[model samples]
Target chain A: MSNEVQERKARIKDMVVSALEVEPEEVTETAMFVDDLGMDSLGAIDLLAALETGFGVEIDQAELPRLVNIDAVYEVVAEVAGWPLTASA
Target chain B: MNTTTLVRNPVITAWSAVSPFGIGRDAFADGLHAGRATKLALDKELWTGPDAEACLVPGFTAAGVLGKKGTRSMDRATGLAVATVGKMLDDQPRGREIATGDHAALVLGTTTGSAQSMMDFTRDSLTGEKPFFVDPSRFPNTVMNCAAGQCAIWHQLRGPNATVAGGRVAGLHALNYARRLLTSGRADTALCGAVEEYSAARSWLDRVGSGDDARVLGEGCAMVQLECGAEDPGRRALAEVRAVEFGVFTDDCGPALTACVRRALDRAGASAADVWAVSPSGTAGPGEEAALREVLGDLDAYRSPDLSLIGDTAGAASAMQITAVLAMAERDRGAAGRVALITAVDEGVVGCAVLGLA
Candidate 1:
């Protein structure tokens, strides 16, 4: 994996933990929001907003279905922001 | 009377309404008597001129109605639900579950459920860095059933409780459900009504229409206590639920609404002549107005005079119209001898309720 992807992943992890008030360990790349963190509808909304502003991407209501996990969210943000993943940032 | 007959005639023992006018029965009574319109002139500063005017409940604070602990976990919908229930329960001595032992279910109706919270979430998600920063306590309050759930929890009601949304017909639908519960002996007394919380999104939709959104933006909560049989003691037993009919009509509002009303009356074992008055779904939509004029205009007994004053209250509109019908019944006991038809339609969905004087 590229360093840019790794860095963005770390930042996303931190944002999720801080916004949801969950432990850092609770927010792994594979951790599902509803199943792993018990994030309800409000939590989902908050997390989406945080990701949008932090990564400078727009997540419309139609795109909600695609944003189920950390990787999916990161990919969308990175792709939209034109942040190509590299071995080093 | 047999259980079938008794259950068929459920009575409203107590009721309460909180609206733009103010709190309690007297305020509404005064407002109605003086024909005071609670609608506020649209605030140009807050919103554009077209969307400015709305009937908003003034001086409403969740803190005042639902104490600190209660308000902390509640959304605006639940807050209004609990407030209206509190007022209704206060009027009756048997509301105490400890005293009654039996459970009291609450059935609340609304067209736009948690839409306000959703709008807030949209704004925050679109602007904020981390969406998860949203308050944890506000999570449960975002559901459509939040208001009903909170009311059940506060009142300690363990029986069936639900929140229904069907545009203008929601209030009557809630009462209809309450009636079924009472008749089936599922609950002895049910707190039933409808509430609508106007939000920015709703306002925008109102403007998007051909500038004639019949459905007005109204924020308020109103509840009526339903009990089985005439033995119940309240003087304002605002008519009994005889029959409730729900349907959807794409076009031709005339035949559709008339058929629904006819079905309700047929189920109630009443006729047009038996109906003293008609509380048509007064959304003030051009389509509905024309349809109602055609339907009720032919009937000399079916008259409506409240929609002009109350405006359209959405989910709470049916209850508001029902309240007006009940008030009429209180004044003219003879009207009670006849059935009153309360009908509401929105977005092509039509709901009709037949209320006979209890």
Candidate 2:
């Protein structure tokens, strides 16, 4: 379970970094999509879509507001997928 | 230079439009007369729905015209361009009856030219190195200038042909270019306007990805026949382009647009008070509205926001706007109107034209 969580998180990070044209090292948990990565409204939508498709998780339009930073997005994906996620993992 | 001076006044002899609001000239005319809007249903499923409803061309096909072989090679944008020009020629007597040897030029404008083709090719190339079938013919159609080239080939317009891309200002630029060519004695007549075909692939991308942003799925072409001057005195000349001014307004468009309008009016030997009607860029924004009000003067200057029905056609928007003014020239004749100033501002570019009706 821990391994799965780590893998999924890593994949999401990779997708976000590539889609936003930012360095992988720059994608920290505290990184805000707009301020840190220079993601505009269009870029944010694209990033959200990528995260959903890459992780095979569904994100509701209403829940979009909860997805602010990298940590919140990961949490949402994990919660929706019924996976156990830990801070260490 | 003496060569740069305009020998003759360029006139829009004939014009045609194909859009979701209307399929042909008659349909477009009826729609315009009735004040009909062409906004479509935005379906999230197709990306033609809710978030962004665009004006799309209705019942478009390239069957009898291009044939199967030719159709297979061209993308949707090329298909629309070829089809629209065919209809324009067939409908307008002046456009169709022109002699084959007549030195007519072609200028086309577009933004997302061949993006659909590039997407398709990329998707296909992903499958295998030794692909099952790679159509080499589609490659040439993927070029940005393919629509202009194809139009030239179809019409046998062997003289100077060019294509321009300037986001929303493309059509105005093409018209201005045609005006320059005719004035400079490069060609007697030219087919100038914009062509764009919304691809299914583009829609698919938008549906799955492009969120919250407003973009309509639309495809069509609008073209006009421009000649040096009226061929016959009896013919009711729609409008004569007296002067055209272009300005790059990167920041505040108000002052620059005002200056350009002043320059255009000055060149046309007219003043703001002489101008009765104003056709704006009409992008459904406040900045342009403020600029128009400030530059043209008077809150009620016969403004037409027809672009709302046609969508932001980029290049076609300007030509279509001018066409509207020309269409009204016949009606405004009784009032003894001297000129109509058409203004188009896009991104950081401003295009203003003063037209004389006879």
Candidate 3:
């Protein structure tokens, strides 16, 4: 389960980097996508599409606010995916 | 025939182009001076149709050239237009002044924004699980005004945005429109230009329409900054916009262009004897070149190196022709303070513009 979590997190980070056009270092755990990465609304939509394809989860448009940071993104994605969330997550 | 009076003769203070030669103003000028054919095989991913060789801006990838952030969903024509405008803004000394505030306007010309994007979006809508399940981000590229709109947005230009869809004469149409914008006081600075993006869909269209006369396809964008009453003493004026005349013809553009050149020169207070350089469009009708020769009455003036090496850029042809004129006038010490003539013909529309080089 821990290994699965790590893999999923890495995959999500990669998606963030690709969709937001941010460097790996910029995709910190708590870095806000809007403030730190300059993700516009269109970029957020693109990230949503990438997230759905990456995790095979249907993300509601209403939950877009939860995508502010990397950790929050992982939590929403994990919660929707029925994955076990660790205390740190 | 509409023409801008040479009385106010707005000058082109800066210019740039993204061409098969390469990316900047110098890149294109250098390519022209080198005098080599710019044809190369396109990637199969771009086009699998026949005519393997096309003059594409070498090593161009929207995201690769313009960073991936806002360009992920951007189409090629939009990317080329944005790059051309940005290059002008970054390359020219008056860049900061020209692209400033709501006074700075942009007018881009094209046949139909991005033919590939439109085809792709339509294909996606048809092939997707459902018709309405198409990618939303790709919607903008299907519009004819997309490239112009994107350029305005990317550059934050708040002035009037116009997209001229005049086929081969589109570029000249854009220049004329920019001239009017300045003359009307609607804009203090106008960036007028044209863009063409090579694609498989465009190739198929050419094959369908052009019998055997089709020139090999090429992709590029050329832009010039026109300012009215520029106050900077040191500002570079590559040339002054003298006259832009348009005409419609049934078949032979020879008569139409002859009339256009005559009217343009007359409007600019220039005679055929004053034109020291001529940049004729490669796709010009059979008699068009003869007409220009007859009008100018001198063969040497038309001796400027033919820019056909750049390939037929369709809507961008006239703009590229203008670019070639400017590029030549820049180095030819003999051409200083002289008039250069540029002519273009497409479909039934024929147009000509005379620039008084400075």
Candidate 4:
């Protein structure tokens, strides 16, 4: 993966952690927003808005539900921001 | 009109409070007895002007007690109400049983929903790159009934949920509304309370709007559990709500308060001299006090420690004051069997409630 992609991923991770008020270690790639991070539907919407504001991307409402984990969020945000998604990063 | 004739006399089963003094009744009573001011300088980030004071609940974290899921979207006012109701239920042995049932209701009083959230959301919509980029989750918090509705949702209270908005007298209005619900059989148990949240907007408004710099702004929530009829076995009644009266006046609140107190006492079959303690709103100016004195006649009347310690809580003031009176009665053995009167006069409205030891 390129340094820019890694940096963008890191920034998105930080935004997710900050929005959820969770620890960095807790926001693992596999951690589910609802099951692990304790976010409800409303909180999920808040996370979407925060991500949009943070990344300067317009996320479709339908894509919100798919943003369940850190990996999923990174992929969707990366695609929307036109960042190349490497096989492993 | 004679309001005393329509008395139901509901019993106050359990109560709880969150104020600048602390979270519970004991903390409030201790602060009241200490008689020291609890007002503190507002955070510089919250207000832009010179140092102003406010009575904010010390060390309150909603996540500490209510966890984080349902609380993420909750504003300060809603958090206060949820916390107060949670504490009230925790104090009662059968509280869970009562709360889970469909017969339970929640009524909260507030000046408005959350001025802070409303302002923030609107500002975001207007200034953001896009017109609708604001967070949709915050929209619910902007409604006037959000606090009460959130409380019901958080506690599983499925009965009628309502919110009464007004000035300081909102507390009395909420209590009286709960009393009617219980008497009319619309609800068997009512979780009634008042809540106010301190925000830079509210502080600025209070500062510029009232022109009364001496009156410090405060925020907190006070809740009481009201049950219809007499107390059930194993449940102790803190005080019996005998009667409640409220009315508006154009200019002079003295006559209106006097009349309201007269009607409440008459409904309770008690006189002004029978009132052991009187809790008046902090906004009750000299004229209102003089009117109350004229009606109740130099009784053991006092304002809640919250008024001097925390500042005027606005909508929550009357409920906090009533909770203070109940706490006083519970702490002092001599206060038992003595009737207590709680009055809130604000925005040309006078509200009064009569209570006696059960």
Best by DockQ: 4
At residue A43, what lDDT does model 1 achieve?
A: 62
Give the higher-TM-score candidate: 1 or 4. 4
- Candidate 3, clashing residue pairs? none
TM-score of chain A, all candidates: 0.81, 0.81, 0.92, 0.86
- In model 4, which regions exceed 4 Å deviation? A18-23, A30-40, B1-8, B46-51, B299-306
User: In what order do the candidates fall by lDDT, top score first?
Assistant: 3, 4, 1, 2
| lDDT for each residue of candidate 4 in B169-197, tens digit (9 for 90 to 100) | 88889999999898888998998989998
**Residue-by-residue lDDT tens digits, candidate 2, B1-358:** 6744637678877777676665566666667766787766654564432345666675455543456534645666777777667767777555555612358788887875767788766665565333423334455766789988988888778778899886566777888898888888888778788876665555665456545366554556777778887667654556677888888876877777878888888889887677766788766266666776776666485635355666656556776777666655545554245677778777788888787765
iRMSD, per candidate, in listed order? 7.0, 15.5, 3.1, 2.7
Off by over 4 Å in 2: A1-89, B1-6, B42-52, B64-69, B99-102, B128-133, B200-219, B303-305, B331-336
Q: Which candidate, 2 or 4, would have the higher TM-score against the true structure?
A: 4
CAPRI class of candidate 3: acceptable
Candidate 3 residue B57 C-alpha distance from true site, Å: 1.3
RMSD of 4: 3.1
| Clash tally, candidates in order | 13, 6, 0, 0
Rank order by DockQ, top first?
4, 3, 1, 2
- TM-scores of the candidates are 0.73, 0.71, 0.89, 0.91
Over A1-89, each residue of candidate 4 has an lDDT whose tens digit, in order, gives 67887787688778777677688898877888889988777667878988887777899999988888877888888878887776763
Could you tell which candidate, 1 or 4, scores higher by lDDT?
Answer: 4
The single-chain TM-score for chain B of candidate 3 is: 0.96
**Overall local distance difference test of candidate 2:** 0.69
